[model samples]
Target: MSDTPQSVSSHTALDQLRQLIQQQAAQQPLPGERELAERFAVGRREIRRALNVLEEEGRIWRKQGKGTFVGPAAPVQPLMLHDLPQRSNLLEVMEARIQLEPGLARLAALRASGEQIALMKRLLERMQLIALKDGDQHELWDSAFHRAIAEAAGNRLMLGLFDAVDAVRREPGWQHLRELARTADRLHSYDDHHRRLVEYIASRQPQEAATAMREHLLVLQQTLIEAINCGEEEQL
Candidate 1:
C-alpha cells in the first residue's frame, strides 16, 4: 500500500474523502487507509478520520483484518410531517402509519399466535384504561399497542421499518390529537375498533382482518386531518 496524503483542512478533507470512498465502494470494495491517503493526497490519519465519519453517518462499514466495505444504500425513509405547519407536522408520520400499519395488522391477524393476540388485546385494554385517566401519559401504551401489531407480523424488514418509524408516530402533536378530541366519544370509538381488530385477527380471516385494519386506519387519517385543520384554523 502507498502512503496516504495529508489533508489541509479537517472538515473539508473529511467530507471529500467520505464522498469519494462512498462512491467507489458502491461500485467495488474500497482500498485500505494507506492507499486512500495516497490517492487523495492526504495522510493515513486523515483517511482514517474521514472513514470514521462515514461510518458514523451509516454511510460505510468496516471489518477488522478484512478491509472496510461500503454500507448498504439507505432506504427511502421519509419523515411523515403533518401538513399543518403550526402544529409541528406529525401528519407525515400519520400518513406512513396509515399506509403501512393496516397491512401489518392484517398480517398480525393471520400470523399471530393466540398468545400474541392476547398480548395485543391487553395492550389495547391498557391504552383504553390510560385514555380514560388524566394527564396525557398514554402515549407509551399507544406505541406499545401498535408495536405489538408490527411484531406479530413476524417480518424482520417490516419490523425494522416499524421500529424506524415508531418515534415519529409518537410525536407530541400526534399524541395531542387524542388528547384534544372534542369528547371521549372518539377515543372510545377508537378503543372499540381496536378490540374488533384484535378479534378479526384472532378469527384468522386475512382479508377481513386487513379490511378492518384499513378501516381503522381511515379513522386515524380523518382524525389527524381534522386536528391539523383545527390547529391551522386556531392559528389563523
Candidate 2:
C-alpha cells in the first residue's frame, strides 16, 4: 500500500526524533512534547507518535512526573514512590536494604573505580564529623555514601531499585525512628562499620565487603526494632 501523506510525515518525524535522541547523552531527559514540536516544526501529535515508536524500540523511557529520558526502558516498572510509605514500614524498609545493599557492595568491590571509592571515603568522613552536631546533614551524607556504592556497582536496574528503597527510608517517620535509634555509642559503632565497609571495597575484597554491608544493615535493623519496642512500652 502506498504511504499516505500523514503517514509519511509521521515517518519523517520518527527519523528526526531518532537523530535528536542520538545527539543526547544517555539518561538525559528530552524536552517536553511542546518544546520538541516547536523545535522540529511538527505537530505535537507527530512528535508523540515518534516518541512512542522510540520507546517501543528501547531507545527512550519515561517516568511519571519526570519527563522522557534518552535510554532504554528499565527492565521492570518503576516503583510508585508516593504509595510506598502507606504500604511499607520501617522494619520492612530495613529488610529490603539488607537484601539489596550487600550485593551492591560486592559489586562495588569488583567494579568501583578508585575515584568512586575515594568519594565514598570522603562522604564517610563528612558523616562522622557531622554526626554529633547535625543529625539531618549526617543522614544526608549517609544516604550519599550508600548511593555512591550503588552507582559504583555499575548496574542501572539495581541502582534504580536501591533508589526506590532509599526513598522509602527517607520518609519522615522512618527518619524519626532512625534518629531515635542513633545513640552516641551506636553512631560511633556505625562509623566503624562504614570505615570497614569502605576499606573492604577499596581493597577489592568482594566477599568481605558484602559481609560487612550485611552486618551493618543487620545492626541498624536491630537498633531500630529496639527503639520501636521501647517507644511502644513507654506508650503503655
Worst 10 residues of 1 by lDDT: 1-10
- Compose the digit string of candidate 1's lDDT tens values, residues 72-154: 53333222333434443556666777788888987887799876787777778777876656323244445556767787887
In angstroms, give how far residue 66 of model 2 lies from its true place. Answer: 27
Worst 10 residues of 2 by lDDT: 1-10
Q: Estimate each model's TM-score.
A: 0.58, 0.67
Error of 2 at 28 (Å): 12
Candidate 2 to truth, TM: 0.67
Q: lDDT per model, in order?
A: 0.63, 0.78
Which residue pairs clash within candidate 2? Answer: none
Candidate 1 has an lDDT of 0.63
Residue 32, candidate 1: C-alpha displacement in angstroms: 45
Q: In candidate 2, which residue ranges exceed 4 Å CA deviation?
A: 1-80
